[model samples]
Target: MPRIDRRSFLTSGLAAAAIWRPLGSARAENFRTDPFSLGVGSGSPKADSVVLWTRLILDDASAATSADPFAPVPKQVAGPIDVEWMVAEDEAFSKPVRSGLYRAVPEFAHSLHVEVKGLQPGRWYFYRFRSGNAQSPIGRTRTAPEGVDGFRFAFASCQQYEQGFYSAYGDMAKKDLDLVVHLGDYIYERTYGAGLVRRHGAGVPSMLYEFRDRYALYKSDPELQAAHAAFPWLAAWDDHEVTNNYATDRAPDAPNPAEFLARRRAAYQAWFEHMPVHPDLAAGFDALRIFGHHRFGSLLGLTLLDTRQYRSPQLETSASDDRPERTMLGPAQEEWLARTLGASQAKWNIIAQQTLLSERDTRAGPATGYNLDGWDGYRAARSRLLDAVQISKAANPIVIGGDLHAFYAADVKRDFSDEKAAPIATEFVGGSITSDSPSEASLAAALAENPHLRFASDKHGYAIMRLNDRSAEVDFIGVADRKQRNSPASVFQSFAVSDGIAGVNRL
Candidate 1:
């Protein structure tokens, strides 16, 4: 492994030496096929750096003709390919800031990850990629601000291709957001429903090639590509990215530990290759960890959590399952969260994670039933986390989550069962981008039993949050129909949480 210098990675004028041309290369010639079919994306923005990503696709004929639109098309050339990336202040390549040549190798599916640094903070920049004579679509991304009065961003999750079209992303792409947080379920591992709006390539993905094909299929969507190209994204994964209801080295459906680990490794590799995450964070399959913190000047501190990667195996919901020994974030990440929250000086400290943190009894009776996959399963762990927030006196702690396929607004309390317990943190769980959800009546019945839950909606859409020094305003937006490609989205509900307040006020 080579050391990466932050300053030289972008400013170093080494493109001439690093650029690798193909055999019998001339000046340039237009080919009969296109290679930039997957499009370009940028993400994991920092104060002075951002990661740009794109994959080479030689044949996209299958994407246009196959009934299963996401089917992976075989590459025309299979070897090391030279890719050039450039970041400029303007849409045109007039004021170029960073330019570099990267070799997209076959082992990594001919994908290029250019970690361009030495950028101005709190500024938007345009970037594009070049391969021979082909040019990729221009993408816009912004670097995080060093200090600012306020910021606006959106958080979304659960985009199942077969369930519905990615219409929500079309709306999200139009939003004037500074950042986008994706709280898991980016891709569904298993295929579902026949004769649907769209279809997955084939069966469930368990190998490296299968996982890579799945990601390529999902990323090939125009709507998804638009959202990624529009802004830098901060993403984390839940079970569906690999398999449903999987925990630390355990797959509930496939109980074999060795087989599940292999599948997880493949899934993790594919995720890293496709996502626009920084190279340093891109670890091997066995050591993959996506939990980290991002600070938006002094206004907000976002802690992205990884709930699925290092959790205890899911057990039957019972009193014993709530023991302190069971962990959702694992011991190390829990401590890291505590330390990060304690040291954070931002006005708002947000936990951008997966699933609902508040306990919701789904049985609709006193006989309690919990989704062992959520924070409800690790009751003691959730309690400890809340306790840490209170003890540290964290500034205006807020929790944003997804993966329940429904929108929920709730107050996190010391004891969810105790009606008198004061709220310690405000939690808002956004709905899926395109996945199906339970009916409104079904969610309403569940809310009747769970008083802590203030608002509930079984619609498909995303959430937009505006944070400032005084308060954080959240609008839970919903689409009218998921089956329709051009479904209209409207604000289903709105809530405001004042600075230092632990509960949300309905607007």
Candidate 2:
């Protein structure tokens, strides 16, 4: 755990308190008459406490006044100037554990992230947010475990808003999951082109101009909102948040530095504003620290990494010697992860990331190589990551990834060079929410040649993981169809990793 800078936090708290006051009797009366339009959310939970979030959607920003927000005004105003949140031990708000007032700034898209601390561990809690007359639908969340037996959580990635419906989320939300791990590419940056798999509406933003608009468009979706309200989410972003295939300091597939820093700042700001991240970490362009570990008691330790921030350029050259000095998790983050995994007391260590780590020399078959933007281009760094897991000898360090728009389960080997390099880890890769799959007969034939790859599917769906003391079971859930919102879901595949196993086994 990171050391708490009490002095700095206190100083910041004082500064915030100076401008913001607690919601009292008078303020509560002023905010009691609106509809629960936007819904509720929770995230960044510790063993004892968790963050509860809500937003007060206004008819318009200016109508919410000292008087009546709903009164017939010539123009609309931001509703519920102040929002209050409460977390309780019971679903009925019978015993209040933590409560507070948060300013629902229109600048922040009328949203608030309130992190409540110092509660009991391993407990389920119900929370809600209110703005004037309108109360958001109540939400449920859980805290981290103080000890471990075994735990379960689902992992997913590459959700393009235009490409498909969010039926996968709808299904996962209903599952008995401890939490949801969103690896990256939660939303796409591209607008609709002709005959695209998923198509975005007009006015979708790409550059800094469309950042706010893009977020609003996405948040309007009921499925996404419901999923947010359903469970605590741990998320990171890939290139689509800003631009497809964007690297740390470069534009899409471009070598020039360009205005990458400015773009990154904008994208980060938009992400923080829309997500349920704590205020302390909401400094947006000021700081970047998403990589962290989550411990479920002594059972499992989950490390969520940011792959785009510090990675080197994806090499386009075919020669092995021409690979760039690339890094998926950067030097510092990689070191931190290795140390964290090595020191973990948990039974399982899971690395949640944005892309696949398995080696696929696509050249041997009808294909050339894996996407340069994925782990294939960063082979050396990926090798080192696997080596870290191997060296740490952590019990069943399962790796979950999403990016290739396909489901893949593989044995993580120390070296692709040796046929018998001991399997160090198991990887489960989920497909896209609604993206197109590669359609090559040669590639279809290539699957038969790959021995290490246990399973691969180019279908659209999500993965559900159930953890127990003896093993972790995962189900690859397939969507009925990607084009329809009311699509059904079915289990397409299942795999498990035992306590002592280094690779996945089919069920």
Best by TM-score: 1
Task: Give lDDT tens digits, candidate 2, residues 1-507.
Answer: 111111111224443343334546634423323434546678877897787766554544444453765576433344446666778766656777787777766666666878888888887787776544445666888888787565668777877777778888777777776788888777677753334544456553435536766776666677777677777888888778777787787776444565567767777777776777777776557347888988888787888888888888767664555343568778899999899888987777888888888876655645556667778788778878877887887777888888888888988877764667767788899888766655445345445655667788888888878777888888998898887886898899999888787777898
- Cα lDDT, model 1, residue 459: 85
Candidate 2 accuracy as TM-score:
0.87
Each model's C-alpha lDDT? 0.83, 0.72
Best by lDDT: 1
lDDT of 1 by residue, 1-507 (tens): 111111112222245234322324433323235577777888888999999988877554654576765655544466678777888887655777888778888788887878999999999998887666576777889999999987999999999999888888878877888999999999998876554788895899888889888888998888888888888999899999899999989887786888889889888988988888877655567758789999889888899999998898776756654667889999999999999999999899999889999988876767777777888788888888888888878799999999899999998888887888878899999999988787787788778888888889888999999998888999999888878887887888999999887887899
Candidate 2 Cα lDDT to native: 0.72
Model 1, position 276: C-alpha lDDT score: 88
Poorly placed runs, candidate 1 (over 4 Å): 1-32, 60-76, 193-195
